[model samples]
Target chain A: MSKIAVIGLGSMGYGMAQSCLRAGHDTWGVDINADAMARFAAEGGRAGALPADLDIAMIVVLNAAQTEAVLFGETGIVADLPKGAVVIACATVPPEFALKMQERCAKAGVLYLDAPISGGSVKAANGQLSIMASGSAQAFAAARPALDATAETVFELGDSAGAGSAMKAVNQLLAGVHIATMAEALTFGMTQGVTPDKFVEVISKCAGSSWMLENRAPHIVDGDYTPRSSVNIWPKDLGIVLDIAKSAQFSAPITAVALQQFVAAAGMGFGGEDDAAVAKVYARNAGLTLPGEDA
Target chain B: MSKIAVIGLGSMGYGMAQSCLRAGHDTWGVDINADAMARFAAEGGRAGALPADLDIAMIVVLNAAQTEAVLFGETGIVADLPKGAVVIACATVPPEFALKMQERCAKAGVLYLDAPISGGSVKAANGQLSIMASGSAQAFAAARPALDATAETVFELGDSAGAGSAMKAVNQLLAGVHIATMAEALTFGMTQGVTPDKFVEVISKCAGSSWMLENRAPHIVDGDYTPRSSVNIWPKDLGIVLDIAKSAQFSAPITAVALQQFVAAAGMGFGGEDDAAVAKVYARNAGLTLPGEDA
Candidate 1:
């Protein structure tokens, strides 16, 4: 029922675009890759130049800079959007950047919802993602259909742009660190005669478990480094955290250390692999072979 | 009913002693502090020197050194314990130390259960702690009555001493880092207009949460740093982690960074406060005042 444009056809964005189409929206898929656009069209997604009468432009780009370029760059969608159309920014950007985007969108007669998402690619595909959303009432009203289509849970954080992003940053800080810690713990257990399967079995039931641990540990157990969420994500996401921390003068030493591990994983050429591959970093350092990995 | 002695009537040990009593055991409370012992006695804990005929001696002492001294020092209890009496070592010591204790206890005709506990003081009092246990079948058999009384979940990881401590170390690696990361995220949220209360309310629902975050974030929101688990615990626990990491030649950068934050908190004179007060390091570094602290 709504005219929606979803830019950035990455794993998350592609799924979200499908969700909008699945909800029977007048959806438009935009991506740098023509293959993604063609694939979306093949999957019954509407294809055309985004209609000037667009009700929502959901930007799911990589970072703050890309989001800015998408909105204010040459041929920016904000210029194409009609008055009162909403822009749901779904990047894990800093709160300040979100506030700035909200202000810029307002100047263009657009409502901006700082709606960063979680629950990863699978949930994104299932239309069961969690959206940490904050915006003005008008922005929420404008963006409701896409939200209803894509999110099973939408945390309505506050009536401001940055609050949603702030909460997302908090979540990323924990999520990123937890993934690395899971790897560290799992491999450390390997050094002590606790097998990968047993590490998964025991720790998941114990107080040591996290959402990330539960989600990612099995990847290591199966020796499957296929990217459910790649090791490359942490550097970008934790980079956002460090940027926010630096700006706020907040010292996030744990987050800083976690960033280093992901960097190490990336450095060790596991960047494109599943984030759980971080266990390999620990295992390699300690001379322990994880389940399914070579000696 | 088995005859049981719970040494070291600290917050955790005292509650454990009460749990043993509640389970219908003839529980003896032992502590260097006469007041703790008297308090336990007033609560119907049996008063006497530990009996030589004790069926179980649960040494819920402080650290590796204390646990060692309690079992093998000149005035040690292992020599005093009857043959086949189980000594449940419920402190977070190294796995190597645990194996050493098991060997020493074995020489004295005793069984040793490497039973490090979780669920904190509240669960300790309720006789519902989770114990990560590994030892011989005979050791488990000898410790059954006390184990049944005190633990709701007992992970029988291996039929020897080291695996339980290894798992505990893995757990401590996650838990200690999680506490600091919670502090980091909570304070980071404050910089972006997310109140401590709202941070708790929102993030708890998001994927960014951990077991420690749910457990410890409330302490910060209430601005109560009452040492439910003090800052001093991390340096010791994560020190154990790094020691184990070093022995295995495993590089734990995140654990190293988290340990430093707790150490800084100790230096800031908040060491005696709850581990949640690690937020103080972030707060002071960023010039942000937390909920109850004087601005």
Candidate 2:
């Protein structure tokens, strides 16, 4: 069995660490949150220092900065990691940052897989995430055990880094925009006397529907803002997308416009609410109340 | 067989007329374009004026202006229609305008079903279009034969004139925004080294995919913009959406932004190309050549 260390212990990371434990690996769950690490320990996950013989280390932090801090920061794990081990970075980061990380890991005699994950927290817990991965043959080989335990679909995008992250940014661009647009359309329908429920019912069956629409519009219908994926996520993810696009001289007006909606949602103190709460921005603007909101 | 008159034999209308013929209706196909009318005649569609005993006169026109002109204009058909005949108005019009048309048709002793259709020309020709119909019991009854022949799914929105058009506007809001967003995302992928083919292959399977992306992105990959649905359609449809939103005092910034992209596309002389050609706007903006364009 592989000796796996999952750093972060957040929604995605905790679930992934559990998947590794379920697969009979010696799994360690590390996080700044002491309660999370202790809870993992209660569930048969190893706590404390990662083993010197760690076979795979999956970085599931928030973004590039955290990923860099954990891998190359003051108390970095790369220097302690065994040669030939793999670092499966599962954050949504810039392709250039991923390339830089991969190069830094290579110098430490470690393999780095530029793997950005999809499917939400529920899918992560069930070991059904779709991973877009890229790295060397050695990186793929070393990361195989955790991957088998955690992912239902692994898209091996290229033999080197960057391509996987590139695909992830493209996907984030589509996903973030769709959620915001779904909210925009739903609220717009309300002003036309189309109720939230009717909007979900008809649009889901129509050609306008997207995967995100089918998944999230129901939340608006129910007036739930419980953050399966929080509103704050878009500002971070889409910000990364817009950053990359700007660096590439790409004109993503829709993405730029969509980012502003998420930012407005955040400004309105809905950063931690479900992303569907972006509709509330439209609702507030149009002076219309959503399903559960008071008129 | 029902005596059916399908006016406006454009791509969508001619297809609906063909569907009526396929279903054994005694269908009369009419159009200002003599070429389109003659082509329908070549396909066994009946030629000549609509009979006074017409059971269903489907106004498959361009907008509220044409619909108003056809139903109440000089030499309008409502004056010649039999009392019990149904006018199935199949255009994406404002809900208020639909209410006005229903009132006029009622005064003329004709039943009116405010029906707006979805599904592209291919679905129209195959009799698989989705129709959102709202009218009284008698109107529904009178329009039943034509609805059965022309639509696969009839969403009975309400027993009124405006509801069907309201739902159509809602559907259009989502549909038009989705098509433009697909173009935006696909071309954004290109600027980041994601090829058009790879963008389609990966994103379609990822969370970013919408119905428009799955159906239209391949057109970009193959470098074919043969107008399965033209770019010009968006300016018309989304303009209707924005118009309705404006009347409702609704703020639709994303939609307003998306409309600009299509408008820019039209301004760039791609008005006649497929709606997927909106990617060309993004392409030109970023100084990147699309798959089928010369670099």
Candidate 3:
């Protein structure tokens, strides 16, 4: 078993750390929250300092900034990581940012794998996440233990850094827009006398359905806004997408409109709620009450 | 066997007429295009005027105007249709328009089934389309033979006229947004060095995928613009959606945005091409070349 360190014990990272331990790795959990680190240690995660011979350091922070801060801040772990240890970056970051991180890791005699994960926290805990990864041959080899521990599907995109992140951006573009579109459609259906339950029941079988629609629409149907994934995610992830699109002179009008909806949801104080709560933005705008709401 | 007339023998109607014939119905094919009528007659469809004893008159026309014209305009078939015969309207018209048609049909001593179909020409020919249908008990019972002949899945939306059309609008909202968003995302990926083949290869298996993306993105990948469904279909369908939303005072910004993209595509003269050619709007705006396009 390899020695692995998973930094940032958020919903995704904490579960990933548990998966590493379950896979018989000498796993270490590091987080800004002492409670999270202590919780991991109680679950048999190795406490205190990370092993000097760590095989992989997974950065599962929120966005590119947090990822950089975790890897290169004053107390960054890269300085002391072993030469061949791989840093598996599992955040949705810009392709250029991923390339820069790979270069910096390489200069420090460390390997870097650009890995942005899909499937959510439940899958993360179950070791069934899908990983879009690209890196050098050595980097893949070094990161395999954590990958096998955490992911059910690993898409080996290319033998470089940015392809994985680029693919991830493309995915985020669709996924983010799909969730917002699902809300828009569901509420629009409400305006037309199609109830949320009927919307889920029928559309799920129709040509109109998407993975996001199927996964998230039911949450709206139940009026449960508990954040399986929150509304705030789209603004950040789609922000990365639009930023990259701007640099490339790409016009993503649907994505732009979708981002505005998420931003509106956030502005309405539903940022921490499940992304499906985006239907609330539509609900409020159209003067319709969703399921489980005070009509 | 039910005596049936399938009006407006376009791509969808022609196939549906063939399906009805295959199911042993005495089906007539009617269209302004005499060539389509002649073609249907050569394929064993009944020739000459619709039977006076017609049990079902399936109006598979283009829009509300065509549907209305077929039902109640000068020399319209509804006037002569038997009192017990069902009129299955299979066009994508507004829900409110459907209610009006149902009321008119009731006044004419005719039964109305607000039955709008899904799946495309191939499914129509195969007798495997999904039909979103609603009407009174008499209407459904009268329309059963035609529904059985033409549809694989029949969604019995409600025992009323407008619900089927409402559900169809909901489905169309998602369907239309998905196609345009597929184009937007596919072209967005191209700008980031994710080739069309790779985009399809990866995204189809990821959470980003939709039925439209899987079905339509390949058309982009192959650079084929032959209209399985045309770009022009969106402006009309979404136009109906926005019109309905406006009457309800519902704001559908993303759909509004998606509609603009299709309008732009039509503006760019790709209206008659495959709906996937909406990617061309994105390609031109981003200055990115799609597969099979001259770079």
Q: Each prediction's DockQ?
A: 0.79, 0.85, 0.90
Candidate 3 lDDT, B200-221, residue by residue in tens: 9999999999999999999998
Q: Give the poorly placed runs of model 3, Cα more than 4 Å off.
A: none
The deviation in Å at residue A160 for candidate 3 is: 1.0
* TM agreement with the true structure for every prediction: 0.98, 0.99, 0.99
In model 2, what are the clashing residue pairs, if there are any?
A: none
| Candidate 2 per-residue C-alpha lDDT over A151-235 given as tens digits, one digit per residue, 9 for 90 to 100 | 9999999888898999999999899999999999888888878898998888889888999999999999898999998999999
- How do the residues A1-295 of candidate 1 rate in per-residue lDDT, one tens digit apiece? 9999999999999999999999999899999999999999999886779887899888999999999999999978888789999999999999989999999989988999999999889899889999999999999999999999999999999899998998899889989999998888888888878888988898888778888888899988888988988999999999998998898777788888888888988999999999998887888788888778667
User: How big is the positional error of residue A186 in model 3, measured in Å on the Cα after superposition?
Assistant: 0.6
Clashes (N, CA, C under 3 Å) per candidate: 1, 0, 0
Candidate order, DockQ descending: 3, 2, 1
Candidate 3 Cα deviation (angstroms), residue A224:
1.0
* Candidate 3 clashing pairs, residues 3+ apart or interchain: none
Q: Lowest summed-lDDT stretch of 10 residues in model 3 chain A? A: A46-55
Candidate 1 lDDT, B1-295, residue by residue in tens: 9999999988889989999999899999998899998888999997788876899999998899999898889888888888989999999998999999999889989999999998888899998898999999999999999999999999998899988999899888989988888898888888878898988887887777888998999999998988788999999999998998898888888889889999999999988899999999998888899998888
**Each prediction's whole-model lDDT (CA):** 0.90, 0.92, 0.93
Give the per-residue lDDT of model 2 (tens digit) for B63-128.
999999999899799999999899999999999999999999999899999999999999999999
Q: Which model scores highest in DockQ?
A: 3
